[model samples]
Target: MSTTTQNRLESRYAGITLEGYPHALSAWFIVALRFVMGGMILFAGLGKLAFVSGEPFDASGFLVHGVDPASPVSGLYAAMASNVALMEIINVVVPITQVLIGVALITGAFVRLAALGGAMQMAMFYLGGWEGQWLAAFDSTLIYALVFLALGAFAAGRIAGLDRYIEQIDVGGEPLVERFPTLRYLLG
Candidate 1:
């Protein structure tokens, strides 16, 4: 049977108080979300590498023409597209990085780092694929970025994932995270 926990969360900043809000959530639900997100990302990377179009993955065309000209970073995209060396590097890096991030999230290894990377990638995609209307640009990439951020904030990996084990790894007779406190930023 799955269990839910009640939590009261609050925050304060700039002389304003965000009152504690009581909420109930199931850890299993978070694990499921993590799995679904990881699987989708993994498949996306694999699809790129598998190349259903029988052509190597390339970002040049997308960078040059797919992006909306009115996007704030359109010039940056065009510059990147025009640089042969950079494009080549990007072509090879994107899919591999996606795969790595997917695996890390799935396995719950270095989840914070993976989440950060995933969020950054999604942010870039959100900016790159803007469709002109600033207010109407709430898209999948932005949602994905938020999801990644939430996962990191909640330390989802610790809730039934390898991160729970990794955090306890013994280092010189003490738990790894405890021994190196800063590792908390990367592990959970």
Candidate 2:
């Protein structure tokens, strides 16, 4: 191509050099989303953690708070509400899983694993009882779930996080993959 043509192309596109982001500055937007989502997930876990302070968070509230006729999953949640053993187990699992997922997402270590877990959690919330008007577009929980899944699919963490460094390391005795084979699916 001629220098003039190349210059024109560069000028037209300006800073944005990647797909999905229109402007050069917009590429960071992806990482920014990851940060925001990670922070929220982390805080959410803390909010449910009992020893932190005040009243302990109880997962049973998920079922108790809603008896809405419109919610199709209300019956399932109601059934869970009756089982003390299950509720107790869920109460413990929810916070722990959320914390793990949050930490993974924040550090961009095993991002795909974190995102997949986040997606599952959000999907549960959406199905259990996310009160919203969108029957077609999707509610906040579902949106977050999709976001998590998308991040995983793209390995969005490699953008500006520790996952990039983790991808580079290797030892003679055992490759990173050999030590943690499942990480192959989780980290990108």
The prediction achieving the highest lDDT against the true structure is 1
Error at 151, model 2, angstroms:
1.2
Candidate no. 2 TM-score: 0.77
**Model 2 per-residue lDDT at 138:** 79
RMSD of each: 2.2, 7.1
Per-model TM-score, in order, reads 0.89, 0.77
TM-score of 1: 0.89
Model 2 pairs in collision = 15-24, 16-24
Candidate 2 local distance difference test against the native: 0.77
What is the C-alpha lDDT profile of model 2 across 54-170, one tens digit per residue? 677776776867545457778788888889999889888888888888888778888998999999999878877655456643778888999999788767778787787786678
Off by over 4 Å in 2: 1-23, 130-137, 171-175, 178-182
Put down candidate 1 lDDT per residue, 31-64, tens digits, no spaces. 7878888888877787778465366899888899
